[model samples]
Target: MSSTDTGARRGRPPQTPEQAEEVRARIVGATARVFTRVGSRGLSVAQIIEEAGLARPTFYRYFANAVEPLHAVLTASNAGLVGGITSALTGTDEPVELGIALIDAYLDWARGHGPMLRPLFAELHDPASPVSAYREAAFDDIRAAVRGTFTELGRPVPSPLDLDAALHVCEYVVYRISAEAGPGAQPDPETVAAARLTMIRVLLTTLGTRADVEYALEVPGLFPPPGDD
Candidate 1:
């Protein structure tokens, strides 16, 4: 078996939940940087160690190879976005408004984390070796949230064709917009902003929801705001 699969097969047990969480977080954060720097296929555990400031053995203590840590990073990114969507949905009675806010939140996250998102994009497009199952789960979660939002709005949950179509639209919109604005030969920020706004408007229209553009102006914080900032 490859070393990448060994950690799952045999590895030291966690002494405590906190320790496990810290190790997991470190692996993920490191993987994000490594993947951003080297792309998915080119990623190296040594690179992750350098980025994370952890020892070589410490890397193996958490993950078998770059792939596992990459998975952790993708999974964590999805979980964070899904959790934000859940919070936004539950915190408000108006699902329509929340839906708009969710789109903004997603775009904002992509803009801020384009480097991390790029490697997942590579994994998502990998044909011979599909290594993005974790990222796929994240997409599924987003779709589920979208479906639920439609139901909440008293609209029929989209037919499979429509749902698939809508998701593709969103995926493309987000990827292209972020790609243009991401580091290296960047476009004008105003142009990127215009494109993002156009995509958001198009997505909401296709999803059969009406919301104000001002909703985009108010990006929701990941945690509680201090005194309603």
Candidate 2:
């Protein structure tokens, strides 16, 4: 067979960079679906090709291996997560408000992805995984943002250890919530409310001063208590 025959059978070759990127995005999208079905450890190139309805050669033309497209999927996830954090925290200076909003944004992101969120959540703790690196980098970015927030508010910055602890504590709460929920759906509002409260308590108690925590408690329904949920 000639190159022209190959091109014709492959369905018109991508004629421009944008078209090439569209094909790559299609593969990434298919990889996400396959990853959702089997989780990352069980994913395979054949599964991706089946999902994308592409030939073996076409799949190889785009990715070196099954794992490569996963990196692309997670790269987009990292952008979404970090951007979500920025949006959620942008205008808030109150400790309780910031805590609740950030957690809400995270749950919203999880809900947006449905079953796809499960494997992504698992990858957060696997240090060797691409998602883990993305997670750490995003956390560092958020930490820097927090430092800037305090500076802008004319408050003393929390120690690096305290900051890391607070973020990690909140992360653990989110992870537990994700684990408890069914893979095909988001956590119900009641569960989300509980998670919000859990993270808020961690955030206020861990990072905020005694007075900040007291003020949060003092406000009438400023931050809902665990009892409310």
Q: Which candidate is the best by TM-score?
A: 2
RMSD (CA, Å), each prediction: 9.3, 4.1
* Candidate 2 lDDT by residue in tens digits, 55-83: 78877878999999998888788778778
Predicted candidate 1, C-alpha RMSD: 9.3
Global Cα lDDT for candidate 2 = 0.78
Model 1 C-alpha lDDT per residue in residues 1-229, reported as the tens digit of each score: 7453333322454567776787678678877777777787778887887786666776787778877877666666777777776666565555446555666676666666655665555566566433456556776887788778667867667677766676667677666755665543344677656655565555555655334334433545322345764
TM-score per prediction, in order, is 0.70, 0.85
Error of 2 at 49 (Å): 1.0
| Model 1 poorest ten-residue lDDT run | 2-11
lDDT of 1 at 171: 70
